[model samples]
Target: MSFKEASKQRGLYLATVARNLRLSPHFVRLTVQGEDLERLPRHGYDQWFRLCLPTGDGPVDLNALPDQFGLAGYLKFKSSGLAQRVAVRNYTVRQHRPEVGEVDIDFVAHGDRGVAGPWAQRAQVGDQLALIDQGRGFSPAGESDFQLLVGDESAQPAILGILRDLPRAAQGLALIEVPEAADAQPVEAPEGFEVRWIDRSQSPARPGQAALAELRGLSLPDPPAVSAYLAGEQALVTGGRRHLVAAGWPKSKIEFVGYWRAGGAT
Candidate 1:
């Protein structure tokens, strides 16, 4: 579904960094707070938002941008000088406490490689930023089925959110790949659900390769209604989904997202 359609609440908001901490060797956690968060809706599963950072040693004028995100809004932003003076990216909502007007975002930090990563690494308290709520991407239909959630570190927060919000009786398997074993964190799910952490340090290539390989080799229970959610590098999502479809899983039952393209920021 489109972001507009999926979002329960939509708007442009200004926020300030409240806290920043290193969550692991590869992840950085930032707590952002703003009164605007009081109006942000929480759908409880895979909720995400668009972020905009000021560009080139100048402060961003968030009010100069469009209130919504779309082709028309994008065109406006593109034609305006704001586009050149702002850096934009997408991120998941790891935690939200609207009562206190705060939201937490987990960023996959790859040193100085990308815009958001580097910015997050140096982010300081009281730094202002912009966000546009895009709502959630994963919302499984009610049915009798075992769920499969898989992705690299970029997808970890979303997968963990899904696990935490899943029904107590839900049965599923979540495979998450990270740069190092230390990047793995606690994930809460049903008693019958299983969560596996795949360390990419064991391999020489990028992160998603290990997860994709595992999915290809895994054997599922017989005759179970399966709902699968896959995200991360483009190839992993495409390849894993292809494997599932080839194994007779219905396309409608699978939610696959390419969270980022390989070799560049996405």
Candidate 2:
């Protein structure tokens, strides 16, 4: 591989800024574009990146640069630096069009009440964030004839990434849990695969009451490999894994992740 390609293979500290867009009632889209794109590491399916923002920066304007280096420039404002940590949770790269050097991250906009959500709520074109992390690429799909993907809003980005990476012939089910009827939207997936969404958050993540139910009742096809990936609320994820394994999935063929735990997970 060329040096340029090799450099793009590793995560770099993006000292740059990008524009933002409100995507849905619960999601905000941050579009970061700069020369730093030349160094963005290629990561796994559903990988996340660290977005370090200052707690003091006020509202931002999309049409103009914030008279300095954007949020990155806020460091000089108070104590010569801003509060930093790997605080913001992991988010999926919804679209990575390297050809144009633009990547999109959809942040769950929880009515500007969340730390990250509110930050994204007022994000603008001149807003700068120190992106210092990138997840390893999505888990390798099984060489089997089919696959299964499960998750809720938090896990949707990763699930969607995997689906878009699948071959046209891959077959399986992708069961997702969103908020209400309005949150449900058409998604592109392999034609052979079935996509189902359940509105469970109208109340709360019910520990797999809906997903585990549907997954347990399904008839899985036999193939060289049958992989199942379950992500979302912690309790629900655990139950899904147990149910899948009990249904005959080998431990090696299943991947379960707790994207979030109920009862005030930070």
Q: Top TM-score: which candidate number?
A: 1
Candidate 2 residue pairs in backbone clash = 26-109, 43-137, 44-136, 44-137, 44-138, 45-137, 45-138, 71-128, 144-225
Instruction: Compose the digit string of candidate 1's lDDT tens values, residues 112-199.
Output: 8778889999999998888887778887645568899999999999999999888888888999999999998887788878999998
Model 2, span 61-113: residue lDDT tens: 22221223324433433333233322334556677766656778777665534
- Misplaced by over 4 Å in model 1 are 1-9, 222-224
Clashes of 2: 9
**Model 2 lDDT vs. the true structure?**
0.63
Each candidate structure's count of clashing pairs: 0, 9
Per-candidate Cα lDDT values, in order, are 0.85, 0.63
